[model samples]
Each structure stands twice: as structure tokens, then as C-alpha cells.
Target: MVFLKILMERSRLPVKNFKEQIMSTIHDNPVVIIQGATGCGKTTQIPQYILDEFIQAGRASECNIVVTQVSLLKCVLILCARSP
Candidate 1:
């Protein structure tokens, strides 16, 4: 819960529009493109947001999130950095 709060604080995704726009479009459509600058929490918060929403709706078992990391080194670094 605390960790989510931290991620929410750092996230740049607009909360109001995130639910109305992004999440809804993701559910209603087959494909969606999110364009944003770096440090916008796209790499971290977005997936968490999806998972949280699904869990809250009691559909987490029906959802799957696949993250394809381009760089092994960067991926490892990110995982390490995010670890408490």
C-alpha cells in the first residue's frame, strides 16, 4: 500500500483521464498506444495501475501483463533499483 502511494506520487499519468481514457480504451479495444516522455512512470506505474485495477475488480486472475525489456542490463538494474 505504501509502495503504491510512492509510485502514485511519482507517476505522471493523469489519474482522472487514466481511468476514463487509457484503461477504458485498453478494455474496449484490441490495441492501444501510449506515447510519453521519459521519467513519466510508464515503465513502472502503468503496469501496477492495470494490476491494481484488475485486482480491485476481482478479475486479476483473468488478466495477464507481459513486459518485454529491451536491455538485459537495464532490466536487471531497474529490478534492483525497485527492490526494497
Candidate 2:
């Protein structure tokens, strides 16, 4: 839990500031496109947000998330490493 708190604190990226808008848009749409500058947490945060939501709603088992990256394999690995 402490580790999670620390991670959350460190997640003060610009994209974190727009989390509500992003989640709302995702909930209301079947497909969404999010574009942001580099290091804005686009690669690390959004998918986690969606998965967290699914877990909270008791739909984790039903959730299947796939992220495709061209050259950000490190980000993907980091994200996976952070997962519980």
C-alpha cells in the first residue's frame, strides 16, 4: 500500500490532471483517441486507469487490455512491472 501511495504521488504527470475527462470520455465512447506530448503519462497511466476501473467494478476477469507500441517497449515493460 505504501508503494502504491508513493507511485500515485509520483504520477503527477500532465495526463494525470485530466484523468476524469479521459475516463469519462472512455466510458461514454466505444473508441477514443488520446494524443499527448512525450512523458505525459499517456503510455503508463491511461491503460492502468481503465484496468483499475474494471477491477473496482469487479470486471477485472472480463477485461482484456492490449497496448501496441512502435518503439516504446520500455514503457510497456515498465507498466507491466508496476502492475499488481
lDDT of 2: 0.85
Candidate 2 TM-score, true structure as reference:
0.70
Clashing pairs in 1: none
In model 1, what lDDT does residue 77 have? 88
TM-score of every prediction relative to native: 0.58, 0.70
Candidate 2, residues 1-66: lDDT per residue as tens digits? 998996876477889899999999988999877888988988788998989999999999988777
Ten residues in a row with the worst lDDT in model 2? 65-74
Candidate 2 lDDT score at position 50: 89
Clashes of 1: 0
Q: Which of the numbered candidates is closest to the native, going by highest TM-score?
A: 2
Off by over 4 Å in 2: 1-6, 69-84
Model 1 TM: 0.58
Top-lDDT structure, candidate number:
2
